[model samples]
Target: MKMKISCKPIAAAAALLLGGCMVGPDYHRPQVNVPATYSELPGWTQAQPADADAPKGAWWTGFNDPLLNELEPQVAVSNQTVAQDYANYQEALAEVKVARSALFPTIGVTGSGTRQRASAGSTSSSFTRSVGSGAQIVNSGSLEGNVSWDLDLWGSVRRTIEENSATAQASEATLANATLSEQIALATAVIDLRTSDANIDLLQATVKAYEHFLEVVSNQDKYGTVAPSDVVTARTQLENARASLIALGIARAQNAHAIAVLVGKNPEELNIPHSAAMPTLPTVPVGVPSTILQRRPDIATAERQMAAENATIGIAVAAYYPTVSLSALDGFTQSPLGGLLHVANYVWSLGGSATETIFDGGERSGEVAAAKANYQAAVANYRGTVLTAFEDVENDLSGLRILAEQADALDTAVRDATHGTEIAFNEYQAGTVDYTTVATAQATQLADQQTALSVQQSRLLDAASLIGDLGGGWSDSQLHDPRNPDKPPAQPAAASAASAPAAQTSSATGQGAQPAVQ
Candidate 1:
């Protein structure tokens, strides 16, 4: 008796094979120690849950400088460093799509035609032998379509997609970080430029005062009331003040060039006018130290790196399982190139294959071990990044606090010095003190004023630094993940601005001349 094989059991087996089990552990975020409050300040509040999803503002706007407000926005558009990072981010998103494509079957179509001359002796069929001793011309053609699928039975492809997705998110964070840095740099350069202007103004006033003193001594010498040495001393002091005033121009020019470059312009293309105006030092609120995890882009980059490395462990673990491939071909072929698509000439096939490595000299085990080690290193790096972020905020806070006290003390000294300079000049005019005493008092007053100006500059610079260290309004929740479209979006609509569509279009093939800033 002939036995029949049931198609039902074979189909069921195929279905079970296609739906294979995953072998690796799922990912979970690693825990790290977080401080409840910032040590530098008191009454620190934790970041509210709602704040995580809140839209970030342009932090530079708080400085209240109209020129700065105008220049800061250009950094996102024209700065080459930020543009390069944005391009890298677009490339990362494309990688995620590449990894994702592996989850689906690859379908292709092919067509071919060939003409050949066959000798009679080479013929294996009677029909060809009947053609004669001469070579016979033969034509063949095929129209075929194929489907291939590397089944993700162990979820290796999915894990790879996960890794790429995390990496893409990390790239987004890196772009944000770069943008914030450039903005802060621009602000710093502006501060230095304004400080230079203030110094020039102070030196100009000192030169005028010195010139007046030289005139007074010269008049007294003509009247035979002051010694000739007094006139020489006054002239020397005036010349030195003029020399210092000329030197101040060098720093002012250099700072102006730096500001121009930060805004993505040539030095000659921009000319900031000297203004008595300066950026106001902004008051930044210090939240709990743990907020750094959600606030800082560098911290987010580290965290995402950890997640990517964790996904890599799953991919490496999957290497131990067998790889299964399913293939199908449907085609039409004819030897004479006639009626190729006819029912009689049509052909089809379905096949499945599985490959397993029984021995690899422990290569697979080594790969798995390496992947785990990388993940551990990433975890360590993440924790280290968190600690460094806290350190940065603390340092800024302490510097600002201490610098404020110093500024107040310098103000008092400046006031007292100005009064002493007037008294010394009055004593010199009354012939009670020598020109040396008046010169000494004037130098002290100038020094005190310059020191006070420097303190103000430091305070402004520290304020910008503190804002940048706090992520300049960026939050970890703003990461735009191309792989997880259904997840709640962390990127605000305003944050997307001009970058959203550009990023979307670049993912199709990852080719773009310039990537937009977020």
Candidate 2:
């Protein structure tokens, strides 16, 4: 008998396996128009395609900053945003497991024993007759087990699993994106702090020059060689230069505080160097725009969301189909203690059921429509993200190019300003020019130096933006592979193992390009 029952379950499972088919429109990545080369920038060099399996991790190391390299990994493990997304990804994974569990049978066991007493005068004389002259006691015991399973006739459970799995993948991508963003912020803050220090140094030098001019003017006025008005102008210039130095300190302090936060330290704990240590901006390899589909985490996240929405449509459509279920109960029951273990007291039941919703007030149809609409919205968002990514990279490229040219021009200006100041000082000492002329030349020199520093900082920021927009050379293998969908996801250990060979290849070939920064 047990064999017969098992046969029915086996046959049902086989039928279900053969009949199941994933419904709804399958997900296919939307076609995007991509240019072979960026047209917005002239003389842009494209990176040659390397071996498909190459390690690009720790792209930040190209900057050669030991501190930054050490801090980068902490973002993935400890940053609040990344931690939150990791929790979300785990939750989605559990949901997928929950949905998949519905495909199997559920078994439950129950046992009970009871005793009851009846009063003699509780009923009519017939009830008394049934109980007999003396008090009668009745006792019963039973143990039972039930098995139930829902036959997924329309693939609803499968679709649910699919949707949840895709959502989990999206959450994983979110974690990666958060890490990328934090690293970029850390690098930018560091560069800004250094720029501030450089500017302050320039301002300090200017203030000293102004003080010297004020002393010279005072001497000339005492000797009646210069008017009182000229002395007043010299004093005012010195005061203004001092004020400028104070203002520069404000920004430098704020930038230092920002860096402290990024490194997971308190502002008071941070001790950045007072002098400038200019960061190097690495030369980024601009790959093809088509590669953007796989490289950018936000873009990958959008694509995964689309997959989830597509699966939801299938789930909604399945609501129109009937549901089938099988149930069975087996047990033994006896009224007497001696008969409790007898086979004659055994009881069993088995059944199957089918349910079909005849009317739903158009709710099911509305659900299907909503799912379709959501899928369309996801597709639009994905395209927009891709376009935005392209624009960001191109914009940074243009910025770096123009800033490079500006820095060159500023270099020449600083040299010319220094020469003018020297000549002006010589003439002032010879009594051919007023003290005011020397002060003006000194101010010009300071402004030129500060401007040059500002341009360098801008160049560094643009470099950071370019690296970020290009996804920091992140590999597609971290997310999904379009070429081999059946391959299991690369675990951390597996990823590390795979990356080793690529690292070796990169080292051997010397194909690794450093960041372009001075």
lDDT of each: 0.79, 0.73
Per-residue lDDT over 1-518 for candidate 2, one digit per residue giving the tens place of the 0 to 100 score: 12124647556785676467766776787787776655443333222332233225677776666657777777777667677777887787777778777877887777887665555544333212345665544566787777888878778887887788888788778878877888899888767877777777777777787778778778978998777887898898889878888998888889888766765678898677685566776645555566666778888899899899999999999989888898888877765334665678778898999999999999999999999999999989988998998898778767776786688799999999999999998897788987678778887888899889889989888877777887776644576432234776664333322222110111223545322233
For every candidate in turn, the CA RMSD to the true structure comes to: 10.2, 6.1
* lDDT accuracy of residue 352 in candidate 2: 98
Which candidate gets the maximum TM-score versus the true structure? 1
Pairs that collide in candidate 1 are none
- Residue 167 of candidate 1: its Cα lDDT? 95
Off by over 4 Å in 1: 1-20, 43-56, 119-134, 485-488, 491-518
lDDT of 1 by residue, 459-499 (tens): 88887887788787777877877777668766544432221
RMSD of 2: 6.1
Model 1 C-alpha RMSD to native:
10.2
